[model samples]
Target: MAAQQSQGIQTLLEAEKEAAKIVQQARQYRVQKLKDARSEASKEIEEYKKAKEQEFKAFEASHAGTTSTTQAALDKETDAKLKEIEALFQSKKKDVVNTLLQRATQVQPELNRNLKKLQA
Candidate 1:
């Protein structure tokens, strides 16, 4: 009976060791899974960033010609407006200068009414 009791105790100890090993294995598996998840998440984030950058580049490329054309149209419009303004100024310059000269040279002299009243 004593021998049987020692055998049972030894079996229990072996079962406990097995359970401990299983627990350790479970913990290691969980840690490895977490690491894999983190790496996969990083890879997904990098892919998303690359995709966005590609989209941005595509958008810029698509609009590049339109942007230059728009700029050229605006420059042409601005140049036309400047030419119109210069023509208008040239047409009106002689008239404006003549009017100013006439106004400056044609001042009329008048007697003061107050001086006449004082003298009377």
Candidate 2:
């Protein structure tokens, strides 16, 4: 009877050791899985960032041509307005000078009349 009791105690100790080993293995597997998940997530994020950067470069390349075309159109419009202003000034130049001369004569009539008589 004493030998049987000793064998039972030994069996219990063995079972306890087996349970501890299984628990330790489970913890190690969980840690390894977590590390693998983090590494995969980091890789996915880097790939997504690179893809977005490439998309932005493509957009910039496409818009560059439109920007130059728009700038050229604006330059042409500015040149047309400048030419129109020059033409308007040329057409009114003679009238503006005649008005100035009349105002000057009115301001000093005696000196202007004497100068006109001398010229005649």
Candidate 3:
């Protein structure tokens, strides 16, 4: 009977060891699955970023010609305005100079009131 009891105890210990090994394997599998999920998520985010960049580049390329043409039109308008102003200045310049010259050459002379008191 004592020998049979010793064998039963040994079997229980072996079963406990097997359970421990299975638990360890389960934990390792869970850790490996978590790592794989993170790697997949990173790959998805990188792909999304690249796709957005390409979309932005396409939009910029589509608008590039319009931007340059609009800039050229604005430059032409500005140049026309400058030419009109220069022509107006040239047409008025001689008249303005002649008026200034006439005002400078025409002078009125007045006698000092103190001269009478000095004579007295």
Among these predictions, the greatest lDDT belongs to: 1
lDDT of each: 0.99, 0.96, 0.97
* Tens digits of per-residue lDDT for model 2, 1-120: 999999999999999999999999999999999999999999999999999999999999999999999999999999999999999999999999999999988874355777889999
- Model 3 stretches with alpha carbons more than 4 Å out: 1-12, 94-120
Let me know the TM-score candidate 1 reaches against the reference structure: 0.68
Ranking of candidates on lDDT, top first:
1, 3, 2
All candidates: TM-score? 0.68, 0.61, 0.64
Write one digit per residue (lDDT tens) for candidate 3, span 40-84.
999999999999999999999999999999999999999999999
Highest TM-score: give the candidate number: 1
Clashing residue pairs, candidate 3? none
- Model 3 has an lDDT value of 0.97
TM-score for candidate 2 = 0.61
Per-residue accuracy of model 1 over 46-73 as CA lDDT, tens digit each: 9999999999999999999999999999
Model 1: which residue pairs collide? none
